[model samples]
Target chain A: MARVYNWQLGREMSYWYPESRPKKQFAAVFDTNKCIACQTCTLACKTTWTSGKGQEYMLFNNVETKPYGSYPLAYDVKLLNMIEAGKWSGKTYEGQTIFESAPAGERVMGWRPEQVDYSYPNTGEDDCSGQVDHGALMQLPHMNWFFYLARICNHCTYPACLASCPRGSIYKRPEDGIVLVDQGRCRGYQECVRGCPYKKVFFNPMTGTSEKCIACFPKIEQGLQPQCFVNCIGKIRMAGFLNTPDKARADNPLDYLVHIKKVALPLFPQYGLEPNVYYIPPVHVPASFNRQLFGPGADAAVETYKSARKDMDLAGLLCLFGCSESLMTRWKRTGDIVVGMDDSGTQLVRVPISEPVHVRTSFDPVQKLVRINCP
Target chain B: MRRRKLIVLPALVVLLFVAGCKKAPVQTTEVIAVAAAQLPSSPTDAAWDNVPEYLAKLIPQDLVEPRLAQASTPEVRVQAITNGTDVAFRLRWLDSEQNDTAKPGSFVDACAVQVPTKLMPNPPAPQMGEAGGGVQIVYWRADWQAWVNGREDNIKSIYPNAEVTHYPFQAQSLEKGSPEQKEMAKRYAPADAVGNRRQSPRQSPVESLLAEGPGTLASNPAVAVKGSGVRTQDGWAVMMVRPLPEGLAPKKRTSVAFAVWQGSNKEGGARKMRSGWAPLAVEEKKP
Candidate 1:
């Protein structure tokens, strides 16, 4: 065991191996407020990568309606309960991580879901917390609430799957920090499937091994966002590189949202994997519920998001999302426009933080014509 | 005085018994490898009748990581018959379930025979041996036996209704049986594309593994170690055949070890029941 710095926990914690970060960590920020549960990103990833013989149940990217829904049944709730008692002590978590909580002779404290656990990918799809009684909303506000939660492999800085593989098959790519399973080395042990708390890694029975989301490295190498990020219907996703706090740059869009403004937070940071994908908590969700899902920062993130329109830098970066197919390494706001640039400072996209508004009256006097919209 | 006489009476009887003994009682179990005209190819082979059988008691392998949480098989009966060129050993053990399918969160019945690669005045540690003195393990699995028994290794074989899509390698995506189609199919089956031995077709039901200490098991699929397993009424019976282990021949003294995994109990990899090294005393063939 080695003590490594987990930035999410804001303290050094026990990890299987010493901390060694990638040169450029592949990362993304998802705006939960903008997501509408329209699974365009899901089908985009499904048709592109997971539509195969053995991958029938594998959803590399899935959007579940949260508060009453989950893929693989209750993958999140189960893990959250397994590694329970891990409460945050202000910024630093005082509880043991999955690695630290592992029992004698085990690498990580984890449980493998039964084959039947995967039978229902969308078990509680679109279900809300409370029921609606006919037209109750007309008389009084309905209590029901749900939000779309789009998920992909977090590609952690300290990947539990990489640590639990007895044969050392799963690895975090040092170039991009993308966790991957080396197909040749893997022997269908399913230790990775058991180790991952998020239940992202899946066992492909046809191939007799495990497979997970590759983060679309091919497109990333070609300087483009992944298929899911580009195809997001609500423009809720932005793919970029995130830097650690010590080296965070204001120009980097991921760092700006994740570090500078400190609005976007990693999911389940208490698990101590230091997951790269960050999420801007939904404004409508209760702070208590959001805190458990995101972290102690979820309340602050939601508050910041509620006031985003007043902050041009925050609103500017949100506009730049899903506006381009190319990956933006650096971004900046200039007046009403947000310019997204590649690593070489080549402008990839220019999105206006505020859109121009033009309204026409019902009657056009000059042409002696009456114009009515949406009759 | 009476208590002393009672103790000395038994002691004098034991002294007479000790003086009558021809040689010192053998401390280690000597598995006499009776040189045979032909090795036993299967557990039911008649050639094994002429060879000596040694029953080894098994204990849960809790020495290393991923320790077996529970006990499964209690013991295994071992027999060895060797030809000059090749040696074959038969392992029979008690198991209630004949689990021959490998699935996620499930394991298959398996057994492995470990033979020391480096020999000398002192034998290596029985737990996969030491660094300089490694062990060559011939591992056999029930699922591989199913494969050798003509079971197709595909989704349809396991879940007949599973995975009915236009195979990316087929007509809809690419021309069937074309080079491009083959490459496209490999995309879906990454393990097979990279030639992971587990995903590849099985000619024999055994894998030849080399281990130098714990958690260092490595196997090359190219190296052939032939074996077969069959489900018995009480348990399982398996036969492992390979070239004579490094330093074994007629009139040679060596040792061997065994390990067993019960699939229904979720035993595999480091979680298993194993036995210590049982000395082998090779004997010349009778005319």
Candidate 2:
């Protein structure tokens, strides 16, 4: 008799889920509608974590103004433009992802929050107060067309940072799904830096370790919101425990996850990292713009967005997981997918709502975008 | 009258002593010693304390001063080492003031070299080479080299030296041992003087040929005979030594080479060999 060897033996074995996966994750949901572009979050993260000598320009949490906006300097457009202009191609190896390849001698944009330095050198002053040069432009846009997206760590599902770490230093908590990199074990390969689509990971050259948001585990452990969330003047961000399949969560794969009249949406699902951060699609954008940002046939995008929002059905597809072609088709055909209600009952999202809520339509002084609008 | 005065004086003295009676005496405890020998002999003995020196000089300047800590003689400069392994080492530092302090928080804003493990005389280590086997050199060619003619070519950029040539096939045979070896093996009979005559007078053994006996054989020879495929070559024996370094990670597919003791009966088994394994560097294109 031929001996049938079991491939899944030892580490090749069964699923090993740790006990009481500490829901130690610290998460933040920035209500993009409420961001004022005041850069308070950027400053808070800066003064708290990135104030060290090399971190003069480092911003842990930043507010990026999209569609003509950026993080002070707006690296998104520049990077996106490069990527779109066929100047950049993602790294690939033997049909596998090896590392990100940039053109030889291509200049990596440094973190420049402003065009000019604002702080006086060697002053040791906590606040940034400097004499302005007339030649320098301060808030120079003749017309402000960008919307603010105040971002921190998503504490994503299947976090790219955790997966790309070669040293096995990065780990995601089973309970709360909070991903973290162990400072002691990191060899500073910067794989996480290259793999992270959002470019959230920062390399501390001194420690030679990649550092990002810890998700404020202490705050989460105490059952309070994170500092950024609490301090956010717009009050759009929400922190919650994303449920797993074993433990049924408030949202379901089908009903809420699929687009219904009311639902939430995901950002860049094609990145395929399974982000935990869910969004209520910015309403009122043009159909083509929505299709390009979300995907083609977003009437289906609306349906899937609804399934993500609503807590009702799990035809076994959660936004946490990619959906089947059938589900996508159903969503496309019937734009009535219902997403679940948020922590607060104020905003009700659905697939194919009467209309889209465009961020450019109106702006609030405190919250950069208006949350509630008539379709 | 004098006697009466004395008795009164004596009685007065006793009464005064009684009036001055005090409470219990307070005891002072002796100081306990942890051991006088435990103190570091000199300040320089504490060299390993600076953990920050492990980082290279390329570290951005802003991170330097804040993390630099100083200590006394045997001045320890600790730095985080993010090399093949994430281990910290102590080194020297130069401070802005240029004054050397041995206490904690004293250091220079510079980098240091890796400590060589080979220098320590009585350093903590396990036994090298097992009881039966020690250092031995075996020659069976197992190197990939570009051949010129039918002989092993010494390619400068590819190989180490003129003497060090790589054979396309994995193993080779060593001939006429070194002067040191010839002297050590004086007791053994020479190939020509031996009773076993497997070849004619014109044919010489691989050892004799390598020993300047004849230079007619091919440059790269195959050690393995046809039909028998053996991955582990026992002929290329080595004197197994100490265990690998604690920090060295072992890959599943690794190559090992060594020297072994040679014997007449067992033709190819080597003795007293030094075995080592090196990581094969595979080049990859950056993404």
Candidate 3:
């Protein structure tokens, strides 16, 4: 008979375990199908939180087309290409999420959008007391379809940001799970900036601190939604709790992470950060494309993905989950997202596999939704 | 039976009294560390008194440097310079002659400057020793402009001598990265470790000042000073100032900051002032 260890009831187990961290993990689900790229969410966040000095060029929230779309220039392609070209291998330390191995002075490369070649358009200078030729002629080429993707810090279950911070400046709150950058303690290593796969953590020269989306915990504490979630014009976003692993891994967090798609598919699961944010792949984009982007196990991963994406598609998932809904909608309506969902098909949920959630011998999995089986 | 009943009653009474005493209210301070110290009741005339004296020896007050041309308002002007796919722009004054090379695009764009100024005592003597010198700030407008290249942008403000003396910004504003955008250039910035991109210029000046330490109200009329600098046991800070410069608009409120020195060294203090500069919005009180 399987022993049921009740933590709340204070049942003693044979094994001794340290107290769990106060901060819990969270997940976001996005439905790409309902997305209508208006960029209202983008403006809401930028104007409200990031509209400060150094943030002028930063879109803490941005929408991008798949295939060729990316903010800060071809961010995905650059990273993907490096991995594919064997120039970079996702980091692994004793199979645990240590830090990405350094490539002899090669910091993780980033794309500066300003370096790209494109056209600019004139935004009429109606308010410049006198005529200031303040407009750009740059215009993106129109295409058959596009989808938007909003992005922000994933606040992952096993956040790469937490692992990468050398000074331990970044911490996830035990009470609410919101990741925070302690301004006074941060030495500004910028390692977290490079270590984070999402590239959400940014450096600020003004305060000499690293700043990111706070998930508006101040509001969350009051049972209020985050600024982005509340202001999402499409109403495609939601704030909710995420499930944590009951058992401890001997070596790797990613090992347990990618497999969750059998039940919580992460966006670009192949990248292997074990991100908490999940998405339902868009409709127009072929399932094959998802397989390629997510990996050969994409179908097998659908269950995990579906649990995360019960409501939203990839673009929608990214938008609703983070602080970038406005950009997601904008990119969705525009041809910016090269790898967007196709306009056909109604595949919303992934086929569920009756896999039992595993629990550690010392602890039992508490049910919020999925059934947990403790060993 | 009567004696037994009397014993039980006294025991119950003592027990009840002990329980009541255990339920005492927790003691807590009503005032937060921040609220305890108030802003200076009057303007600081000390910092201002030395401005004229310093400017007199540094450069001719009447010296017509085109770069120092005064704008009617204190607002810093903006302009966009380039427009192609690989967009790049220059920042300069609004009324000043356009730099074929530089232009201000948006009020929300970021910019950098390397000024050699520091916090000074009354008579404006440089105090806090020279730490790393020359800090860069990214400037931006509160309003949104399309993320594009070659967009001419301008913002309005109402402050005195607000025109940018360094017309034609040699470096790109915060919209783009800076040359010293790495950690190795520590001497130029004391706090910058996350590179310059993280600095949000949109933060209100008051919030930024409050993040620093504790200060008391300065009551010296000679300086119209409203606050005194206070050091804490652990060295965190909070400060406030009042009676800002006359002739300044409401937007130009003053926020004071102090840099403490390990020891008082006359020559060291003078050198520190020549090297370091604090982000200031404070104005001098008139004599």
Candidate 4:
């Protein structure tokens, strides 16, 4: 094992291979507070990629209700149990990562779920953390709490799937840091499926190989976001590139949300994969539970997210989510409008700070139709 | 002196007991290879019954990464025969379940017979040979055997519950069996599109592979290797046929290795039970 630095753990740790980051890391920020779990993003990804035979059960992008819901039934809780929860002192994690805690002959500390584990993809769909009593009313810090967690492959800096492949078939693309299974070289070992803690990589029975989310590379190469991000009904997703902390650019929206504002945090940062997909923790969830799910900065992330309106630059970047299909490499706040710019300084889109609302009459005179609903 | 004897006596006894308890090295016996007019094509052919069976003890492969600990299969009864032009090997192992599908969370029962390309004074290591001393492998897979035995090789056959709403390869707009449709279908099955032998349709139950070390196994030129595997009451009886190794003639000795994988135990690749190189003494005449 080679010792490499994991910024998420705030320390250097052991990895199977040496640290060789991509020229540009494909990353995204998902605002958990805005996700409604409608699964439009799920369907969008499904129809676009995994509509084949062996991938019948694959959901490259899925939304699960946290605290009681999970795809593959408790994927996080199972791994977390094996690795055991570790302590975090401020920004530094004082714990054994999945790699550091691996068993004698194993590469990564993980458990492979049985086929039956994937039988129920929507288990505990809308279940809350606690039951509601009769005639219960909403209040601050209510007993019942649940949040939607939309997930895709994190495309980690040190991908467990890439590390665990004995055939050396799985590789991280040097161009975009997209971890992929070399379909031609893979012998259907399914080691990646077992090694990945998040259970993103899936075994394709028909092709006799493992497959995962490609991060919509074709669309990305054409300067567009992924299907799931573009089709998100809740507008909670924004896909862009993220740089390391030392090289974090303030103009980059992903960097602004992840490094500068510190509202978006990587999931299970203690795992030490340095997953690129960041999340803005749900504001209403308890800090303890959120911390366990998102890492030590969950409480601070929630605070910053709640007060996003005060920061025009931050709020402007958040408004650009799902605003356009094209990828915005950079963003800036100009007056009351936020301009999304490409890498070549081309403006892709512009969104106002506040949406304009014009009240319509109850009855429409032009169409001669009665309006039952008022907007 | 008396105290010393008392202490040393018990210590000697403990040492002897521990040595006895440890597993002894498997006897690498020289097994007889029966001569035949033509090598038997079937595992259960009457010709195989005439040959002596050599029980090769299997040990977990601990030489590389992803090693196995005490593989489920402990031993495989091996029988070899030569017809000058070709050599055939029959391996029978006890397994309760006949696992023949390679799917999600599933593995296939497999076995391989490996021989050095040239018979040398000192043969290569049994762990898939060493650097220059390459080993030619005739690998037999239960799934491949099933495919050659007329089992359908399609998604519907493997997964009855599969709901394929749309597959560009099977799109109604594309004419059936057209080159354009095949080109479009290649996108869904990347492994098959890129010509992965395991994913492509095959008529042979065994694949000819060459290996010079761990993780160096790859396809070799076709050498007219044939195989047949039959499910017996207790386990599988597989017959593998291949061209005779170099420097092996009638009334001669060569080296060979055997490996077995129990699919139910999730064994494959480096995680399977293997036997060290064993001597194979070929007979001059038919038994």
Candidate 5:
């Protein structure tokens, strides 16, 4: 076994392969507050890939209502319950991960889902916690709260799918940290499906093989964002390459949201895979509930996002979201506007720190004159 | 140190036994030639009642098993006879539980007989074969038999409460030659495309497969073999029949291997109970 540092967990973890970092890791941050549960991202991913036979049930990108909904039903909840039952604790999770919890001869701890478990992809949709009275007025802290969570393959540093493949068919690309399953080498064992806690890997019964999101490597190679990232109707997603934790730059939008401002946090950091996708927690929900979904940083992240207007750098970085097709490697505050630059130092997008507004004109019927109205 | 040596010695012997050692005891059978009129057509034929039985020991595939465990069906009885046209072999193994269905996360009971295509200096690797070794296998699956016999149930039959109002592919108005219809048809079994409708009775459940090496197993489209299996109170009685391929002289000494899968144990792929190559001597007819 070899040990590698997981920045999300803030500790070292064991992996079967030697420590080898990718040149640049595919990363993204989703602002959950801005999502409207439109599912355009899901459709974009479905039409681009996973439209073949046996992939009818696969949704590479799914927007699910948190505290209620999940694609494979209670996939995350079941695994999270297992971890909690196993007494997972500590800031760095001193307890066993799924890899370390395997039985004597097994390579990983996994459970094969029943066929019935996959019958329904969207169960308990939009079911929120708490009830509301007929005449009660709602305030900042509402009685019932739910948020849409847009999820895609995290392309983790330590992937469970890569570890559980006995035939060594699954591999992580060194160029961009994209995990992929080699179709020729795979024998349709479905071990990766069983081992993945997020349940992202899907088995193609027609071809008798397993497949998952490729991170749109074909598009990424040409400096284009993935379909899910570019086609998001909510404009809540930002895709970019994340630097290693030790080498993170403050100018990078991903780094600014995830590290410097610390307004975005990884989901289930206790899983110990160091997932690349980060989330800005919804502010309306209770801190404990947010903490259960995201890690201990959820409370702090929500607080930072609530006060983002006062932080000019944070406000400037937020302007870069949904800006361009090419990933922004650097950004700067120029006067009252933020300029996003690609790796070649080409300005891809320019947005003001605060968007400009225009007043509407009201028509006066009797005088047949237009009157300008201001807020 | 002396006590540790004694403990290690027995384990080494067991390991060698499981490793397909030639010194391990093997049941040898002599194939007798019978008149075409007197040859038995089925495994339960009365003619097979008088044949000599050879007992072969089946060992667990420790190389791929989840743990190093003993074989569930340790011993199997075998007998063989041949007519001028075809050769038939009967394999009887003890498995009290009948596992004949395949579900998600579950496997079906199966058995296979492997013979090399050509003579070699050393027999091919018992785990399929090495490249260029050219191993031909006759595989029998219980689930396939159930499917052919109309005893297998579809998804709706398994989950009765599932609400499936309509399937778009089943629509009659859709043009059969349209691309949308063709794409929808891919969801059905490959047999459906060729008009071999499901739940139809067939002559045999066994399929002919060939492998040049591990992970190279493929179904032989030639349809050169046929077999059937019957489940009894004690175990399964399976009989496989095929034409004796060229290259093997009638009286020459050759060998064949046997593998059995107990579905209840979740055995498939490389995880199975198998016997090392056993000597097979076909006797010539008397003038």
Candidate 6:
């Protein structure tokens, strides 16, 4: 076994392949609170990449309502149940992850989902717990608590898809840490599909191969953000390169959110894959529930996000979300506004310190007519 | 455990022969390519009766199993004949379960033959070949054969009750003859749409492929090999015929390898039963 540092796990972990450190790792932060389940990101990804014949059932990027919705219908729940059946302590997993717990002669412990499993992509859409009684105006903070979770391939530091492929067809690019399946090499084993805990990898029976998100590498290479990131209507996504935790600088929005302020935490960090995508846990949800999804850092991340407005740097970083077509490499507070800039130092966007107010119109029953007035 | 017995039993037999200080007759099975009086019209023709049979022991591919394990057809009786123009192989394997259909998670029974591009000092790795060493492969699929024979009970036949209310590229669609239909077909089934029209009987179920190591196998695109299979009470008898490549001279000694996949065992890719290299020699007709 080869050992490598997993910043998310805050320790080193073992892997079958030798450690391959990319020049810059692809990273993103999604604020679950701001997502509205519009699925613009999902459509953007589908139209741009996965609109092929065997890809009819695939959604490289999907927006599912959390605690209820799943694409392969409870893919996460099944894996989580398996992990729970094993040993786990606090933030550290004592037993094996899906990759480590593979049976003898197998590369990873995986399950092949039947066709019926994929037949329903959104089996439990918008299902929330603790519903309020009908005809009741009593609004409780805990009632009707569900959020949209926009998911894509994590492009993990230790991708189970890459490790599980017996033919060594799946690989992570050394430049950006984007995991991809080599079409020519893949033999449609579906092992990658089976081994992926997130079920992001898909098998194309037509071509007899497996495929996954390429991270919009073509667009990224042209200095533009991924289609999903740029087209997100909720503006909850921020894509950039993650700096080493120790070397994190305030100028980098990703660094500030993940390393300095520690406001973004990886989803299921206990899986030990050091997944690159981070999430700012929803503040309204219970801490224990958030902890189950984002690990022990949930409470701290929520607190940091709640207090973000008081800190100019944190506030500016928050404003950087979905602000530009290009990947934001740095940001700064200029006067009363925050400006995000790309690697070339070109300003991509500027947001005011406080949102500007607008006038509105209202109608009164006595007048029986529409009225407009400045507030 | 079966693999251990396969290795240990052979070694023990060899040890006993040596310990007895007796001259043991070495039994060798050779596939002699005969210049047929006349080539058999079909694989199941009476001409095949004249050919001698060779027993090949099939071993589990434990190198990549469960992660790669599936039910494997343990042994196959092979017979080969050549008309100096085309070479045909009749492979009979015992598989009580005849699995021919494929579904989302299910597999189809298949078999393949591998021969090196040139005779090597040491045979190419049985698991397709080593880097820089090229191998020619003829792969036969039971599913394709069923389709070629126009057998009902294909995928659509198996799921008889499946109601498809809407399909994007249905024959009735406005884009039926347009490029969009071609694109959709290509995405769904490249083999069907990409100029490779499926022909019954004439178009063999076997595919000709070339490989230069693991993960380097590519379809030859020539459709050079022809094959058919029938399921009997005991198992399947498959016949594959292909003209020997020009590189192999007539009467020259060479070798070929065989691999079998049992769909019932869920065997595919690198998970299947296979044999090491076996001797192959072709004979020229006496004037």
Root-mean-square deviation of Cα positions for candidate 4 versus the true structure, in angstroms: 8.6
Q: What share of the true interface contacts does each candidate keep?
A: 0.52, 0.00, 0.13, 0.51, 0.10, 0.28
- lDDT (Cα, tens digit) per residue for candidate 6, span B1-287: 99999999999998998999834322338766666765666556777766777777888676543334544677777877777777888788888787765554667788888888777657677778878778889988887787677755222354555454444455566477798776764544433444443322234677888887766778886548888888767887888888764555565777788889888777777778888778777767657
Q: Evaluated with lDDT, which candidate comes out highest? A: 4
Using Cα atoms, each model's DockQ against the true complex is: 0.39, 0.01, 0.06, 0.40, 0.11, 0.20
> Per-residue lDDT of A1-375 in model 3, one digit per residue for the tens?
112232211231111112344444444554454556566767676666664433344456655555445555555555556455221122211211112332322222222222121111112211212333455332344334455666667775445566555335677788767788766466343555555667677654334355677776677665455676767766656555544445422121221232233323455544444455554455565566665454444455454445543533332333323332211111121221211121132222222222256545544357435545543
| Model 4: CA > 4 A from native | A129-143, A357-375, B1-28, B161-168, B197-201, B251-253, B285-287
Off by over 4 Å in 1: A129-143, A367-369, B1-28, B221-223
RMSD list, candidates in order: 7.1, 31.8, 29.4, 8.6, 10.8, 9.3
Interface RMSD of each: 2.0, 30.2, 17.2, 1.9, 6.8, 5.3
Per-model TM-score of chain B:
0.85, 0.14, 0.19, 0.87, 0.75, 0.78
Models sorted by lDDT, best on top: 4, 1, 6, 5, 3, 2
Shift in Å, residue A184, candidate 5 = 3.2
Tens digits of per-residue lDDT for model 4, A22-100: 9999999999999998999999998788876577878889898877677777899998888888999989999999899
Consecutive 10-residue window with the lowest summed lDDT within model 5 chain B: B191-200
Q: Give, for candidate 6 chain B, the lowest lDDT window spanning 10 residues.
A: B193-202
lDDT of 4 by residue, B1-287 (tens): 99999999999999999888834323336666678788786987877766777888999988876678566799998888888778899999999998988876788899999998788888898999989988999999998887787776568777767555667667788998899887776766667778884743578889899989887888887666889899999999999989888778766778988999999998877789999888877778744
Of 5 and 6, the candidate ahead on lDDT is 6
lDDT, candidate 6, A157-211, per-residue tens:
8998888776788888889988988775666667788778888988754445677
As a whole number from 0 to 100, the lDDT of residue A326 in candidate 6 is 84
Clashes of each: 0, 103, 89, 0, 0, 4
lDDT of 5 by residue, A1-375 (tens): 567777776668776566677888888999999999888999888767765544566777888887767767777888776666333354556666666666654555666666667766555454343344453332223236788899998898888888777657788999999998876566555677777878888765434466788888899998888999889877899988888767779888898888888898887777767788999999998898787777778888999999988988888888788888888888999778999898877898898887687655598778899887754
